[model samples]
Target chain A: MKSLEQYTRFIEEKIAGINLEEEPRKLYDPLRYFLSLGGKRMRPILTLISGELFQISNEESLSAALTIELFHNFSLIHDDIMDEAPVRRGKPTVHIKWNSSVAILSGDVLFVEGYQQLAKYTDKRLPILLKRFNETAIEVCQGQQLDMDFESRDDVTEEAYIEMIRLKTSVLLGCALEFGAILGNQSEETRNHLYHFGVSLGIAFQIQDDILDLYGDPELFGKQVGGDILSNKKTLLFLKAKAISEASKDARFGDLLQMAPTDSKIASAKKLFEEIDAKNASLETMNGYYSEAINSLDQLESKGLELGSLRELANFLITRKL
Target chain B: MKSLEQYTRFIEEKIAGINLEEEPRKLYDPLRYFLSLGGKRMRPILTLISGELFQISNEESLSAALTIELFHNFSLIHDDIMDEAPVRRGKPTVHIKWNSSVAILSGDVLFVEGYQQLAKYTDKRLPILLKRFNETAIEVCQGQQLDMDFESRDDVTEEAYIEMIRLKTSVLLGCALEFGAILGNQSEETRNHLYHFGVSLGIAFQIQDDILDLYGDPELFGKQVGGDILSNKKTLLFLKAKAISEASKDARFGDLLQMAPTDSKIASAKKLFEEIDAKNASLETMNGYYSEAINSLDQLESKGLELGSLRELANFLITRKL
Candidate 1:
């Protein structure tokens, strides 16, 4: 099995090969800068691993892998503007370094580039790939809208939150896996199962992200802990906390939650969170999703001859600390 | 030839027929709303005329026509935010009605829809159409950047301004015509000539826009008269005036020109502009382009058939006061 560092290096090498078109230099320079200031590159690497699992490691799969990653970064650029996020991956966001307008246009050009890259596939898979990518793109936009909408509402259900996360975050990962399967010439059933594997893994990953936002070690985590709490973000942990702890019994907890979870409120919210054990509850829910993801992987094994690479990917994704 | 109002109604009726994908309601609602606040829909009608001239009114041509219009509106939504313009076509701008973020996302979704709409063509035409569309899209972005960049610089040449407008406003029209020719399966030479025809016409149309901004009847214009002057926008008039009226010979004109064309400076700028007959010079320059546009139309007669509908469309475009 390839180590995470090995996967990271592989993605870096792959990303370096992408050739951005000229003339929209302003629009694409930010893409270059942003990708250079790398994150995990997990999505593309997972795509590569998924392809490898199907015993397919060719230029086409590598290009598909890069296409998804480009698409992912394009979303990040636009999402950062929507979120008003100042930093990403321990660096200034594209919008912050430039202005929001440039970021918006740059992100737009990147989105176009993403599709342009995907269109490089041979005619047989191109239509299917494009149709799926377009559907996923639209869903991601809808998920983002729901997430923004949730910020204003107090009565968001855990189920609704999970569904929103599924659309916003999970579907793209599913797309990455499905795209890999297409490149591998896998059967439709295998592709669908792999998609489920990706979706479940994504949900687990996002839930873990929510947990780490409150409970992670600052030394280990790249971002400020409890950032979501401070922002009053509707995450799985918060939803579970509100759900499991009866409102009447947690009236004080609600009152404290109204304040930004800063130095003073952080302690109180932590105490209340502990009282509800929302962190552990979120972890348990995450584990359930992770278990389901593993099960999907197991199901795919029935059809697959080679399963080692995909299993390693699932394990690495499910077990990541940050 | 169709009257302006006849063409306008045709555009409105045709645009109204566009449908969004079901579900993911929030993402596409703004597109519907933006389209509902109707403009003249001139671009698509121009495309339709291009197709109709060749007697090519198939599903692919109609979809291509619709796609161009959608792409135009998509750009307008983003451009409105960039311009910080509050109103469009006598209604609130999308960014003003919703937020910048929503406007951004909706515009993005519409962009994708434009491509999806284009994909309805046969595979033979699809690649060429998409490639042209992509080039035009990138050119549009570059043009916008040049427009924005013009705001900060005092040294913008008239040639540079013309090129910027060509990139910003003309390329898509050219692509629209060229796309129709491709759909009609016209020869490459014919298609290229038609493209140039549309581009020359686009430049004339834009220059006429500048002329109307200053001199058209206010009620007919549906916008602030002398707006370019008020903003000290580097329009054709300003560029021409700056080029001809030497700073030494016309000290007041030079002084007013150096200042930002804000409301406070607008009266003085107008006085200085009148001193140099800048408006008249701009109109004369506009006429030159308009004449050149007509000449290009005359040149298109040799392409294949007479292209009577395309000629009519060009005449209508150049003759419009608003």
Candidate 2:
């Protein structure tokens, strides 16, 4: 019955204790630096919360929680390299601070270390856990592939963008919960309910992220406002905005989006998105997914599992999201 | 009871049956291309051979073999990007054919698929197999890191270079064999002996490679001879000559290796290595490891296992090395 802050502290201490600060400093130093630069640490906390929902103590789930956190950092380090990102969590990225070679090798080590953490669990469930992890890992790669592919093409639809987010980002959330449920000895069907709950919430959260990129509270947000617009990523809002522009024959909309990178471009793009109701449409879609997430949780409640803190966390993901 | 050629054919067919030729063509096409540009396929074949030494069928060991091959390709894809290598197996590398982003994502997929193949084995050995694979995977990264580190350091000793290659190139061979032995139900001690056998042979084979880069027949070699020289790699021959010139106080030898990249630079480097007896020194060192490899095989023989063709494979590794 620990508070969310307690779970966050446990995961952070576990991460800080991981001694990757060894020789071949070129290989491990960047990983140490990247892991030290923390974010919300939401995925590992999800693993802890999922375990608590199953009445498994967070102590029992620490190893798997570490697995999720390590894997998350692995994906981000490699993704930042592929995305050519300069900053992460208000700091230089692994590739930016060291080099891509260091980033690739360190990411590879982090990935292997993730499995090492999982292998620390000697249960018969180990093979099944590894299988699920392998599947989710491949899907994440495929999602990144599709995201890069979308960069050059303009015909990306809203459905495609949602699917991309599910693969790229959401499924890992699903898998993170699923790992805890699996470790907790929940049956496949019951564990899958927890998984779907994560998936729906993950999708909604991503949409909220797209909206926040334009209209979020700057003081609360870690990254630059309107950063996604600057990157030209085909997020859900961008897809919706493109459809609305086409419907209205707004000739100047395309020109506004393609303007030279500047403060004015972001302001103009945000103005057009609000005017065309793309922002509202994205929010509505986000709510729909959020509702679906709650429905999956209700399925769990029907089976007589208490989900008090878990539901609050989901609410916090949407209602009080920074 | 199959011949080495049949083992070779079995591995080729197993690799060919892998269908990564599906969607996200940009992500998969480069993988398909890199795999299709075949090398000696030596590591996977060793898995089959090791399995046979323990009277285990190749079919039982095929999954582990593919794991090794897929992982090998994964390392190469990422390493080639780090090395900025344009060519692989006489074809354009994945990073060259595609871009670094595609290369990074696709390599990540290949790494995960390696675990997928390993997971196909549903036995108690699965966890132990995964544990070994993860350890070997991390060491490979560390090895690559050390190799890159050596590129910048001028005072790298021979022992450090040997340890670096052992980590970078040799341990995977040892791991490939150990995986087969594990699947074959060999005792941990016996499997470890087999692992050492592969380790020694791998080290010797690498030193042989350094020698062949300067002295081997051109038609027999797949890569350009003296390619390492042109790249200014600090190979064993270079280290030996550096030591020799320091002892003899030959001032001209330092300038010979430092000359600009040209055909004649490679020729001068080769001639200087010969003059200093560095090539012979490397071969003697190669023989010591070759002997160490044979002694390990003899240890297996003392346990009453037949060592007929396996011994031949070891001898072939030394006698007929390209």
Candidate 3:
């Protein structure tokens, strides 16, 4: 049973030693540069913890965790190029640091490395593991396509958003947990429960992120709070804000939002938000998903898997402000 | 056995059915457009012919061939972005038609779908097939990196250029053949031989392309001849020219070369190339690799594999002026 810090530290340590930096620098230097700019790395930790829930960690399970992390980072690098993102984890993104073409090619190499890492597990489970991984990879891409589509649409509903996020974000988490469970020789029934736990938690995490985008304290959030609201991005908060407000009340709100959320607009939008109770509405939705996440964990507990450490991890995640 | 034209026609027919015009049109449309702006379909045809050699053909093989072609086109789209090239086959590139970011993301989705199509293979050979495919994918990225690096170096040798082309260009062809052979359930030894056949042929094919770039008749080639020469690109021709030229006579050659490969430089370079017998040098190198390719086919024939059709395919490839 690893503590949250312990799992986080393990990921950092493991990835550090997976040195991809030497000569052939052309092929691997960008990989090293990009992976070093870390995220929460929750996917890989879910893998490690899920494997630990079943039994002692082995080379097979560890490699699977590393493989998923590599794949996850690979997606991020490419996604940054697509999104024209300048920063990742408060650091210059790979594309920003080098160039988009280099980032594109490096991400391709990272994906190939992920597959190579998975191929190291040439055992009885190889076919199943590879097949599942390949399918999940496709799903991730579908999710990304949906996200891109959502960008251009004004009609994105909450349901579409949830499904989009699930495809783009949740499936990988679920796959990470399920892959680890499979490598640990968990029963199919147990793997299914683990997957549910990961997916439910992923949805909750995204919802929380949406709420935070408007309501988060900038000191703690590490990003521009209310940026999404400024863009009129159809996050949960904006969707709920649009939903909860009446047509008669739209006049004052329309005036404030029409300015676009700059310094002046920020104060104005916050005033309208308070008047309409958008933060509270967003929080209520976030709590709903958070409770659903907890309910899934409870369901997992009923299946007789060790729940103490997992519950703690879940608590740490759901309770976090960032 | 399916002739190369039959396989090419099969790919053309398959690709013809794909609807490139759809909503959220940015992602899939480029793939459709690129596929429609056709090339020789050489790699996919190789995949199919290898499959035919192993007695594997059907709708599944057709889908697999389409996958290879789609994947190849996907790479070309991204490569055009990387190279900032405006045209492909004298038509505008996807990035040129749309934008760079769209081209990047669209190519990614295409790569993802390529795997999805390959996953349609119900054969037990998928795991090994995908493993080899992933390796080749990485080599392609590495090859691109080497190509980029070669641009910065003044001393790029003939060996380095050939190796880069082999990895970036030839390996994919080899992977295509190997993928088809694996799906056909051919013997491992036979699959290895076919892979070598593809690799050798790829090398010969690329060398032929270098020759065509400088010397092919413009009408047949469908583009300006000597475009590579104009760019001062470190092609096999340039390397050979550098190698065969007298040191004192060609001493100022290095400084005169420019990035854009202008009309003035092109004429001068061509003059110097013939002066030092670089055309002969390049042709000799091309012939050497072509012989190696034919030797690889001979080895396959020696193993009692029916190679008559393959030899015809090779002849057709070698005889192409464009």
Top candidate by DockQ: 2
Model 1 chain B, poorest ten-residue lDDT window? Answer: B52-61
Q: How accurate is candidate 1 locally (lDDT)?
A: 0.79
- lDDT score of model 3? 0.77
Candidate numbers, best TM-score first, in rank order: 2, 3, 1
Worst 10 residues of 2 chain B by lDDT: B313-322
Query: Highest lDDT: which candidate?
Result: 2
Question: Please, what are the lDDT tens digits per residue for candidate 3 over residues A140-184?
Answer: 776777888788887888788888888788888888988877887
Q: Give the alpha carbon lDDT tens digit for every residue of A46-126 in model 1.
A: 777777776667455777777788888888888899899998888899989988888888887777777777767646667
Error of 2 at A203 (Å): 0.5
Estimate, for each residue in B1-322, the C-alpha lDDT of model 1 and write its tens digit.
Answer: 5666776687787677777865555567778888888777767776666776677763447778777888888889989988898988878888898899898888888887887777676466666676778778878888987898789888999888889999999988888888878887777877787788778778878877886776667788777777887667888877877876774476665577567756557667656666778777777777777677667677677554677677667776777664
Q: Model 1, residue A131: what's the lDDT?
A: 72
Per-candidate Cα lDDT values, in order, are 0.79, 0.87, 0.77
lDDT over C-alpha atoms for residue B213 of model 2 = 88
Candidate 1 lDDT for residue B252: 69
- Under CAPRI classification, how is model 2 graded? high
RMSD per candidate (Å) reads: 3.3, 1.9, 3.0
Worst 10 residues of 1 chain A by lDDT: A20-29
